[model samples]
Target chain A: MIALYTALITGAIMAGLQAASAAPPGGEFPSKVPVPADNPMTPRKIHLGKQLYFDPRLSLSGDVSCDTCHNVAGNGSDGLPLSFGVLGRVDRPRHAPTVFNSAFNTVQFWDGRAKSLEDQAKGPLLNPIEMGMPSSGAIVKRLAGIPGYRREFARVFGGKTPITFEHVVQAIATYERTLVTPDSPYDRYLKGDKNALDKSAKQGMHEVSDLGCASCHAGAMFDNPGLPMGTGWFRKFPMIPTNPTCATYVREYHLADDPGRFDVTHKQSDEHVFKVPSLRNVAVLAPYFQNGSVGSLRTAVRVMAACQLGKTLTGLQTTNIVAFLNSLTGKFPVETMPHLPETPDSTSMMQVAKLQQNQRQLN
Target chain B: MIALYTALITGAIMAGLQAASAAPPGGEFPSKVPVPADNPMTPRKIHLGKQLYFDPRLSLSGDVSCDTCHNVAGNGSDGLPLSFGVLGRVDRPRHAPTVFNSAFNTVQFWDGRAKSLEDQAKGPLLNPIEMGMPSSGAIVKRLAGIPGYRREFARVFGGKTPITFEHVVQAIATYERTLVTPDSPYDRYLKGDKNALDKSAKQGMHEVSDLGCASCHAGAMFDNPGLPMGTGWFRKFPMIPTNPTCATYVREYHLADDPGRFDVTHKQSDEHVFKVPSLRNVAVLAPYFQNGSVGSLRTAVRVMAACQLGKTLTGLQTTNIVAFLNSLTGKFPVETMPHLPETPDSTSMMQVAKLQQNQRQLN
Candidate 1:
């Protein structure tokens, strides 16, 4: 079974590689994002997923949702250096990546631990420091208990028993896949509209390739595609050891302690090796970098140049890059908050009882 | 100045009283909610307030916003018995009241501590257990520092300097006044639509007046107009001392310790007295009552009947009342999440520095 699963994944990666090769120069992003074969995107699934994304009942405290960290209003990021989770837990070690156009990425997370969006959706629910659901079983039980959710799951999946953890993650992933942001100024420029980008942004686009940023940020998503899906193309951050910019970030933001992918791989070479984040909508989504150390995009550009390329960019060069990055800000879809279904008496009555019991203990 | 302010307030109250008496039988809710003369609702102010309402930067933790608790999607309540506040503080003593139709209330808070929505808005910002901002000065400074907010405040207030605490509360209150839910089945019935309510609901509506429920729940907003605006019409909860339902609630939910209005007034008669809540959208906004002890609408009906009227209602009577309460579910305006303005580096860079300093101290 493991071998068969491996073969299927390998086949998918090969197909993705072929598609990558056919991509236009500077990597013209596809207008429509691809959906996984196992979980086909449907209106019912997407609707259900959207409700789930905004619903905080998935958390133990009932105060955090997927939208809590990746707010749909602000470029799919919380605009915090580190995100606050359930019950105002603010010690998150890494920055939340933008959910916009995240479907184009090979892997999810700064360390690329989760292979797919479906897989990534499950991590936060069970993570003690995140949404703080006791278990997958607990989440399933909670959803099953809520009559609205049970009905939604049944309608979406179309089965006698469809309220499962797998369906929950699948639906959420399907909704996320539809969050692809296209038609940015950069994208329009690639589509033969020369005037789409301003003069400064055009110059910065050329500088992007000239400065070897395209070597890694190569695809339509400005994401590395050489690596297989669910696998990361890890690059050692702060490659120039003597760079003052790197030293300052390490000292101030406490970035040196986090071993990046080495936490996942447990290998020396993987130390300081972090996943290359997509630069889509990077302008509005601040503070920058994995640790959220850099507050300003201009400063971030200078630091990236110094640490990654071992070159100090001129003030004009940094300004132009910042302008080009701003051009990547695409039109966000008008997302009205979904009216969540209420928990029925059978479920909520028990919840109230439990809540009372907890309250009593505290008092 | 105090006499002038008093005269102005008295005039407004008299006008409100006249309006209340002019309402038709069954108390038909007005189409347009009354706007306070001092803080007349303006499009620009409402727009700015909407952005601020959704922005988490107002909170000390940058997590909890007004929308976090009073979510527009779910009857303007979090659907939790007690709301979780900053840093997962779940010890909130009372249920979060629905923001919908709140403009109708004579006073704000269960204890009637705040006279207006403007006054109420200020309480949570500085409440150590709520949004947990250090001070109103801190919030003002934060808003003034943000270029977007500064520009918006200027535009809205039509002044060079507009980002004041008074303006902030005024804007928020103005936005909240617009949240009045009208045009329910009950309102339609009041407007001479004979067939608006079904037989059971019709019976319940008749019982509402016959059983003396309308004595407290009077006027177009189904609020007691005898009590002046921002003044409490305090009623002792669980009026029947020997009721089993009251005993169970007091024991289980710890309702006895709250001391409702007594906490504010510190008077013997005020003990256990609470501001009578509006029944608008009551069916959907559950678990019911201020303590949130009763989960089911039917159960709530029974408890209220026994506690307030000193009558143990039959199952049929309770069911009918529940049906009638369901008729109060009004048409909710489609509220799309407003696009919050981003804080420029001139503002956020300083915030980040402070955040890092705090984090360093914690570490």
Candidate 2:
């Protein structure tokens, strides 16, 4: 059932992607985000997705959720350098990217391993270091057992067989798509509101282009928007790094340990190459970069200048760039915590006991 | 500054407690719950508390929150046998009691250690196996550093020093006091609506009284309301030991491991003595008892009858009782997730990194 649903959605997504690709880039940011035909947003689906996103039952320990790391309240990131997973059992290899404005991104994750938001949602559930559900089958069984979720799935899917892993991801992806943070000061300035930006921020915006920052961090999203959604536009970090700032960051931050896109493709050329992250709400979300190694935005700016562009920025220039970055802090949507539905049986209890038993066996 | 505020509030709480104790216990369950005069509910304070309640930043791993255990979505309990704490690092010694209708309880926790909800909120933050903050000072410093929180504190507290451990707990408790699960079928029945309860439920209600089940589980809240808030009314679990079912439950569930109120009082008589939890919403919150050992309501009903009353109920009686319990489920208030404020500095990052380092060293 899930395979059929996935295939059906995939075909619809591919067609939508083609249509999205034909549209010219570098225009005013659309208020309405592009939605795939198959997984079109509905009130019920979004509500269910919100519940699932906040629910920790997705994890083995029943203590980790999508919001555990990508907190909607705290600039869509957990505000941790490395995310703490179930029972703080393992530190996630990379920093949790902000979910705010993620809908605008061409691809998901620092590695771009997952293609769409739907694809991205599935990775964390089964990742042993993340949510850590033993299998998709286990998740399906657990969710299906819950009476409230059964009703919801039936209502949303309108089928005899409603609950599936594919539908779960689709609902989650639909919710993720709604997480776009629109109407930032930068966005207002782009829309011909000259006075929207401060003097320093205005100067810094022009300076960013002059410094070649806009070459990659282009378009309304400040990511390479020309690339199709769920497609990577990889760039080599520390491209020309001989500076003391860049060298110190690499060593101290444990950046070398993660091979970036190389971990996904297993290609030498992909080494150190990562998808350009959207600069939206970047000021509030720090320690900067893939590893979350740098502590301050000013330090991150100085290092990025040396490593990526090889142009040493002055203290004043760094300060202005930071101000400009701060202007990207868009208005966040009000996200109320949804009251989740309860299970009628001991399925949750039995599942938890099984998980605890597995943990005991491992120990 | 915090000391001054605490002293002032303490005086007010004392006065309120005096008034509360003087009031007769068995009035038509007061539609309005008495609020502590000191930590009175304000829109700002309740809003702040709601945010704090859902915020995982309260946890050491930055993963767990009050909502993690007392989920508003699922009858206020996490629906787990043993509530998972920081990183699933340690299994909580007892099942997490539901936050719903908790304000009506005379005491907090299964052990009945904390007096008021304000007192209860502080336990998890410093508990090694719970939220696991290193110290109270650490929590204060973290919240103080966040500019938005600082402003909110100043607004809510109306003082130069707004961010304190006392204020944090006070706000959380104030919000918790509002989590009253009123308007249940049982509540309506209690208010003289004869048809409020179903035929089975009405029969079960009579059966419960006949079985002397209402001795401890008494009053409007289904807890002993004659006692003042925070005062313990302890009853020995598994009062009778001869039954094979009771013996098996004790052995299989490791029920003896948790010393119950004995751990708090160090009195031999306190052994296996737990606070009588309210029957409100009990049907939906399964895996019954302190150990969460019994998965089904039927099993729990049988165990409770054999152990507490020394009377094994028939299958029909148990089903009817379960129906009666289901009638206790109440309407939950629409609780939306709050957008938490961000820290202006890397204080959160530094703290989490320090905690991770400490964990590594301890391991």
Give the whole-model CA lDDT for all candidates, comma-separated.
0.74, 0.75
Name every residue pair that clashes in candidate 2. A87-B87, A87-B88, A88-B87, A106-A230, A336-B336, A336-B337, A337-B336, A337-B337, A340-B73, B106-B230
Candidate DockQ values, in order, are 0.29, 0.38
Candidate 2 all-Cα RMSD: 6.9
- Give the Cα error of residue A111 in candidate 2, in Å: 1.1
Give me the candidate number with maximum lDDT: 2
Candidate 2 local Cα displacement, residue B12, angstroms: 28
Off by over 4 Å in 2: A1-27, A354-363, B1-29, B354-363
Q: Write the per-residue lDDT of candidate 2 for residues A1-363, one digit (tens) a residue.
A: 111212112323332444633221223455666566678889999989988887778888776889888988777988877777765655445889998877766678898887778889999899877888889998898888778888888999877679999999999888888887878887676555878889898777767867888777766667774555656877888676566767776677666667889988999998888898877788988877887777788888887887888778988898888888888888888876677777655756556765554543432
Model 1 ranges off by over 4 Å: A1-25, A225-228, A344-363, B1-26, B192-195, B225-228, B346-363
* lDDT per residue (tens digit) for residues A40-144 in model 1: 889989999989988888887777889888887666877777776665555546888888887766778888898888999999988876888888999998888
- The interface root-mean-square deviations, each candidate in sequence, come to 4.2, 3.5
